[model samples]
Target: MDIKTAAAMHRLRLISLPEAVSFLLLLVCSVLKRTTDFDAVPVMGMVHGVLFVLYVLFWADAWNRTRWSPGRAAGYFVLSVLPTGGFFAERMLRRESEASVIAARARREGVVNA
Candidate 1:
């Protein structure tokens, strides 16, 4: 992958964990609002919303740059909605990026023709 694609994936990976955390916190806040006086859902909601938007934007950039198959792209999108999916996404992205780095190095060294 090129630098831009790598950067986009890296950025999306960075956002995923915080978004997941916000979602979890929102869930907790929802329960608290029902059982007690504490309520922070609105704040968490906005934060998650922003992060989700950023995730989508970065996802689109990565898809366009990498030309990933629709099925692969969908998998990334699905992760955004599920709890703890961001961690999975990060792990997957890390693997992909590492592979890409190795492939890029190979290409540069002419160990494998592109």
Candidate 2:
């Protein structure tokens, strides 16, 4: 993978973890609001929003670098709105990164030294 692809993949991986955590916290805040009228919703919502935006940005960057198909790109984009979807995104990215590493290693092996 090129540097841009690598960077985008790395950022996407790191961002997804925090995004997932924020989503989980937002869910907890919603439940707490119902049970105790706590006001954590706004804070959690803002956090989730920021993280969601970051996820989208990174996802787009990676998709562009990797030239992902429409269906695959859409799947990643759509998952952000669903509860607990960030976890799925993280897992998917990790798998993609692993696959990229393997492919790059193969290419390196196939290249004959001058």
Candidates in order, TM-scores: namely: 0.93, 0.89
Q: What would the TM-score be for candidate 1 when compared with the true structure?
A: 0.93
Top TM-score model: 1
lDDT of 2 by residue, 22-50 (tens): 98889999999999968799989999999
Q: Which residue pairs come into collision in candidate 2?
A: none
lDDT of each: 0.87, 0.87
Q: What lDDT would candidate 1 get against the real structure?
A: 0.87
Clashing pairs in 1: none
Candidate 1: 10-residue stretch with minimal lDDT: 105-114
Query: Lowest-scoring 10 consecutive residues by lDDT in candidate 2?
Result: 105-114
lDDT of 1 by residue, 8-80 (tens): 8888888888877877888888899999999888898898899889888988888888788999999999998
lDDT for position 49 in model 1: 90
